[model samples]
Target chain A: MKFNLKKMLTTFILFFCSIAFLLPFVWMLSTSMKIEADVFKFPIEWIPSRWNFVSNYQEVWFGDHPFYLYYWNSIKVAVITTLLSVVVSALAAYGFSKVKFRASAWLFLIVLATYMVPPQASLVPQFILYRYIGLFDSHLGLILLGSFSVLGTFMLRQFFMGIHNDFIDAAKIDGAGHWRIFWKISLPIVKPAVATYAILRFIWTWNDYQNPLIFLRTDALYTIQLAMQKFTTINGSFYTLIMAAAVSAILPLLIVFILGQKHVIDGIALGGVKG
Target chain B: MPSNPSIETKTNIRKKQKNASKRRETIAGFLFVTPMLIGVSVIVLFPIVATFILAFADWKFVQSIDNLKWVGFQNFQGLWEDEKFIKSVINNAVFMLTVPTTMIISLVLAILIDKYTYFKSYFKVAFFMPYISSVVAIAVVWQVLFHPSQGPINQVLMSFGIENPPTWISDPNFALLSVMIIHIWISIGFNLIVYIAGLQSIPKELYEAADMDGANAWHKFSNITFPVISPTSFFLLITGIIATFKVFDLIAVLTQGGPLNSTTMLVWHLYDMAFLNLEIGYASAIAVVLFLIVFTITILQWISQKKWVNY
Candidate 1:
């Protein structure tokens, strides 16, 4: 088959643009592997002449900066946040979608409306509240803060609504209660949606800089994002080390994105279409 | 005929069971939502209300609730008189310029990729990489790239015979602009995906009919594609504006709103006042102002969407 000229031209243009877009990431990897002097080489080394990958990554990982501690903290916070938020949101979504109770509609509206209030608006009060409750500067505090999301509830509810009521009605006839039906029937159907929201939540919490920045004071409790900020400030002159740290920081999410590209893309699409 | 007493008793028992089950359902519903309700109250709702109240009262981080002085709009008045606050607001407005630029670029990219079946997924993932990455990582990478003396960007500019290039992130003249560029880069991925979704939803028959009417590419796009995608555009427009207005992580990581506070947007200003300065009341006022700006714009968009955003 003959190639269409317009299609070829579009492909060529898109290819070039994609390279331009991915160049920063490429540069990041390159700089991360280069020795100190070669980092600022004028010709822009796409590949370093001397690979310092082992030493650079080692310095970041095993160096005095406590990168491993921050990594563990981030992982712990993200995992707990994702799991709890997903369960809480899924339950709330099910309640709103399937269960009939007094003031349910009004309650759901309140939750949805709160999603519109930017988190920054509530920052000061939350800071004070956390301080008063003795939860300040704690991982549990960060996890709790990230656990409940109205957006998650709203998104999952849309998925739950798509489920036909016949399954629910049939389950009800079999003497299954709301909780049983929610767990045995409805939850299975909306598992993909739940997973989508979970991944998004994990990524959000892992990458979150604001909450940790405001809430955590001690270096020991710092999340990776906060740690990166501190690391950059303290070792600003070491470009290779900073880039190595940056790579280490983003590697997990990048792996997730690569492995679950379809899910991430679908999640984004779901968000757009639903909104 | 006389009614059977046993049957009547059985019917009454069944009615009681039904009521009991109904009560169980209500209890279960409440049980499922209770945790989330508690969370919303403690984390979101209470704080929002508290922030509003705090905005009217003069308080400090060091003070207790008992020492809270009721200043009633004094914080707002102070914010109005503050030069830094005014400059930050203007910076936020200027930062909003990224929304349109991002939309146009992403829409074009989406259109180009949408036409080709091959490499579509590849392009999608490539573009979206930056969006999923941590803001700190992206900021640091860009900071290196924006390095005045030895960065690739300046090096490229100098190779083209430009002796002097503006120092990004450090130069007051170009710090906001530099941040805008980074913002646009990181945002294009999300916008591209959304636009692609929007473009894919447009019915093919419209395009077929337009082709039959001898419509050219521009004509077809302007008449058919543009109007059809207006809802998606409107959605992205509102969301993009809100997201950009809340841009603190990037500022904090990259420029720290530095080089004479040229990059100090609303949320950063709020952070500085509340977290850095410990002026709780003033920060609350800034938060309220930011919320009002977002709320008003969203409401306005909702009201005006009917005029041009075709269903």
Candidate 2:
């Protein structure tokens, strides 16, 4: 009876904490659909008395800075970056893990060491180099900045190490080259790990504010994050509109989270176990 | 004699083929890693070298390479005297307190949800929502929620008989704290999930043995749970401290180093100096310091891991 009561009490406390934790997002959703006047109605209207959902969303999606353009930009950058990064990291991971070479260990160690250098340390020089190379203020430069991740290579390498050598050896005995073995024999086995990484890379690239904020000078090339900031600044006074913009900015992430929750949880678990 | 010569040549050919195949594999390995190697060399490694070099020099990026002026230790001296830089460093140290606070809360919640709660996934998703959301969006929502008089938080406080609630994000005194609150909130989901993972890894036999021994929950937790999860705590701590230094989006979106520079963190200060003030040399110096601090922290953590972390 005591144990049952204790479980009930803990659950009861957690339930309320969860509500308070989700209050910001809930309030955001509610306020976005609310009319401006109903926004400040004290003893707060959890549900809006007057709904302005259509017009509020319409204004945000097609306002002076059309969010659709920014959305497209973010999608293009994130997709390309994730695809390129995954391919690059996976190939390198395969090489370091499966391919026998004299200097493989040392080279991988060098790559791991570079991961310790903070990105902030290199921002200034990267800015200068991009300008010098005529890649400044372009999506290509921004994509290239995130295209190679030492962490991704190192992470995928760990997964690749788990692949049995007999598989690769059998493929080699059949006259299969390293490339063929990597594509046919090894990658499929680590598809889940790769997918998890791809999702994470996409989300990180999509939400990335600093690179886009620094690299992209043209307003049209702005990602959703920068556009969201600008939208909030212009629509600061209209709480309803700002809330609507905020909702739009995070809607895609929420969708991704819903879809990839299991993978994300597993990835965090992998990290913890490895630690 | 003839049979011996033919056999020796046959073995020699096989050895040569083996060496040739080994060489081929090595070449293929090199080819596989070439792209990543080039990308890292150009994007990451080269830039770090440039940052270190540029830290000792004065030159706006607009200026040509010939215009570079080397001044030994001058940028570091500027950092030593700069009030904003000093305060930003201090603010970052204060901001790091959020990591431990968030970890403790997440741990307790994780233990409850992992063992006691009914709907585990429901709780996990709810907590994690803030973490996955864009910082700009979250910061904007928080701006509304932290509104001086009209916000829900102040409204709740005022209703409870506190006449004046501190205007969070606007007041320099509370700006860092407000940001830290949001930081803690966003971090809980990730930390909670990780702690739950760490918790599940603990062997059930140990807990069962403790139960058999009539060991209380507190004693079991202290003797077993806490020590086992110390590695997770250490991992989170290192990453969390590194992350605190890299906090720019929050500052950029919410306070912009604020009414009194109270929330001016290291990265925000670096951004301000590099981009806004066009003090590239000074900013590079700041980045160098940031790098050293992270390096020192990681090294210290590794050394101290011997004492606390179990595995």
Top-scoring candidate (TM-score): 2
Tell me the TM-score of model 1.
Answer: 0.97
Query: lDDT tens digits, residues A1-275, model 1?
Result: 34577677778888888998999999999999999899989889898999999999998988998699999999999999999999999999999999877778988988888887888999999999999998998999999999999989999999899999998999988989888899999999998898889889999999999999999998899999999999999998899999999999999999978887887889898689657
Q: Any runs in candidate 2 off by more than 4 Å, and if so which? A: A1-9, B1-8
lDDT of each: 0.91, 0.91
lDDT of 1 at A224: 96
Question: Candidates' DockQ values?
Answer: 0.77, 0.79
Which 10-residue window in model 2 chain A sums to the lowest lDDT? A266-275
- Residue B119 C-alpha lDDT in model 2: 79
The Cα RMSD of model 2 versus the native structure comes to 1.4
List candidate 1 stretches off by more than 4 Å: A1-5, B1-18
